[model samples]
Target: MTQFSFFSVIVPTYQRNDLLAKCLDCLIPEIQTLPAEQYEVIVTDDGFQITAQEMIREFYPWVKWVAGSRKGPAANRNNGAKYARGEWLVFTDDDCLPDPQWLEAYAEAIVAEPACLVFEGRTYVDRPRRSLAETSPVNESGGYLWSCNFAVKKQLFESLTGFDERFPYAAMEDVDFRLRLVKSGYKFSFVKTASVCHPWRAKGGWNKIKQHREATFIYLSIHAEELVNINSVYYLLFALRSFVNQTVPAILQFNFTGINEAFLEHFAYLYMSVLLWRYSLTSMKSLKNQ
Candidate 1:
């Protein structure tokens, strides 16, 4: 068996111990197939309670577990990167389950291009409603690169100072990191074969709304320039009109109508407009920072 002497897989996790356990279960068999001594897995627990630690010890004894000092995801990732012993750091989320060939592909890609700074991989949502719909061309400018399936050279990661902890929440930090890499003239190759399946769960309305709002912050933080530019003004105006059209009818539903079709249509448009504005703001902020 070919040996990889220096590679580390770092997974930053929160309170999702069950998910983490499942992810590790999927990973261990793959790990066993590789040259064991040369590769390591680091699970950085982001200040979970004692129960989480106990669970990790019991369920994933072979993987190294690092306790996060009350840091957010960005900080947690940075901490894991700090202690990584490998020349290359493969980052994935706690919820992602990589294919068995995942690490093998990374190793192959590294061998093919030893000087590559970043490798962007593909992620497939498990059981998509429509596979054809899932295969659309992703807009890189729209921040499609997910942290759940990306690899970077260790030195490059350190040089860039890892992820910007300024993005405290779960949203746009990845975009900020990618933008920095782009500015630094680092090359990121899209590796379609290195895939992971991201499973979904039922989300409540409040949960989804919060997620969308945070995503707005992320979009604004990274895309500030576009927001201020002339093209963005047109998009902004359209979004404003859409928001008004949607919201006004929905509000009118409270007084004049009782759950009519127009109310639903308007509410949907209003929600879409909110997302558009949020993304525009993120793009505008990113431009300003540049």
Candidate 2:
């Protein structure tokens, strides 16, 4: 069996002290269950105009607080990993509340899959739903895993340089990293027991949609092949297909909640598609000049 020395829980926060406090609340007790040297919690603040150091120190004195560069989430995560002194690097966002036995589950998985370097824990929302259609505990989705909850060997994380800071935000950086790791032939195992609760808060505005559109372009550009011969209309068609796939079954089953969620998802896609297509020409020109 492969033996790991310790685990480092790396959380990147940006002015989310309240949520971070909740996260630490759940994590600290769990860590206390094991020996002190078994794991360390490192919170990296990404250029918060007002630091969380004081609050964290007062309430969660066990946590290692690090002031971060104004760089985006990816950079902040990388920064946290740099200070980590563990054989395994466990990542969870400040907004996530990990399960009581989250660490034990991951430790077990590591032993079970001795050859695997990457492992993803499940994340779901426990709060009341907005609509029956809304998705919660998104890590339940079988597609790509999010960095919101996962673990990798410290050596391996450093080998990939942690995350691609070029993506500039919490967006596509996870997807980009996963794709690259998969291409490099690394197997990832999902441990349902190592779950975390990522609560949802409805942000009422176009700002999120705008961020999605911007991230979509950045995502495609990073992939290179996806950007080739692609236009806004292509994304529109893609969105239409996705909408049908998501909403049709719900409609047939008379699942109003599911249908509502599907509609919202589709609308967001359509909105981004139009915005992306509208600026694709200008965006491409700018990228080419750079």
Candidate 3:
């Protein structure tokens, strides 16, 4: 067996203990394939109500559990990276279950391209059968990166300082971080054979709107100029079309009953747009000051 270097798997979890349990179960056996002392697993609890300490003790005695500063996922990940003891940091969400050959694939890729700073992997939904979308090709520009299945050199992570904690929600922080990495001349390779199952269900209804809103804010923060570009007009049109498709019928049916309720529920998108504009102006001001 070819020897592999040390690796640290960091999982930043919020309130998904059940999924986390399964993720850890999948991780242990994969890590065992490497030198026993060359791997460590760290789980950072992002202020989830349940005591992760006890859960770790009971189910994952070999893993390290750290109390995350009551910050969002980005901050929790940064905290996890701080405590990692390996030369490479592999990030996977609490809800992700890795394939049996996941770690081995990463090790092989690292050996093939030692200068690569980032390793991107494929994700499939946890289901009985794979769909066309599950098997689609992925590249860096296609929004193919997910924290659920990515690996980075430890020194590279430290140099970049991990994910930006400024994003308070589960949103576009990942995009912003990857953009920075790309700008810094870092090379990333997609390891299609290394895969994981993202078990979280798709968000819909008001929850999805809120997610979009949060994401829009982060998007605006990083791409303020692009928002005003010609392409943005097309995006806004698409968003408006979607809103009308979702809301006009309800309005015509005198669903005034659900109007206020719906507004309260889905208004986060509008709020997020407003905040994005505000953040953009703030960023501009800071740039001017500098």
**Model 2: lDDT to the true structure:** 0.78
- Report the candidate with higher TM-score, 1 versus 2: 2
Error of 2 at 138 (Å): 0.9
- Ranked by TM-score, the better of candidates 2 and 3 is 2
- The worst-scoring run of ten residues by lDDT in candidate 3 lies at 129-138
Expressed as tens digits, the lDDT of each residue in 1-290 for candidate 3 is 66787889999888778878888888785444554476789999985568577888987889999999877888999999999999999998887778878877888889888878789888876543221111212232324567778889999989998898887777777777787788788868889877887753533556656775666656665666655641334444544664587555556554353455445444554555455556556777988999
lDDT score, residue 151, model 2? 89
For candidate 2, the per-residue lDDT at 172 reads 75
Per residue, candidate 2 scores C-alpha lDDT tens digits across 216-279 of 6787777766654445677688777865774565565654755554566677777766766666
Ranking of all candidate structures by their TM-score, best first: 2, 3, 1
- Which prediction has more favorable lDDT, 1 or 2? 2
RMSD of each: 7.5, 4.2, 6.4
Model 3 RMSD in angstroms:
6.4
Candidate 2 stretches greater than 4 Å from native? 1-4, 30-34, 132-137, 141-143, 228-238, 241-265, 274-290
Q: Count the backbone clashes (under 3 Å) in each candidate.
A: 16, 4, 0
TM-score of 3: 0.75
Clashing pairs in 3: none
Let me know the TM-score candidate 1 reaches against the reference structure. 0.72
lDDT of each: 0.68, 0.78, 0.73
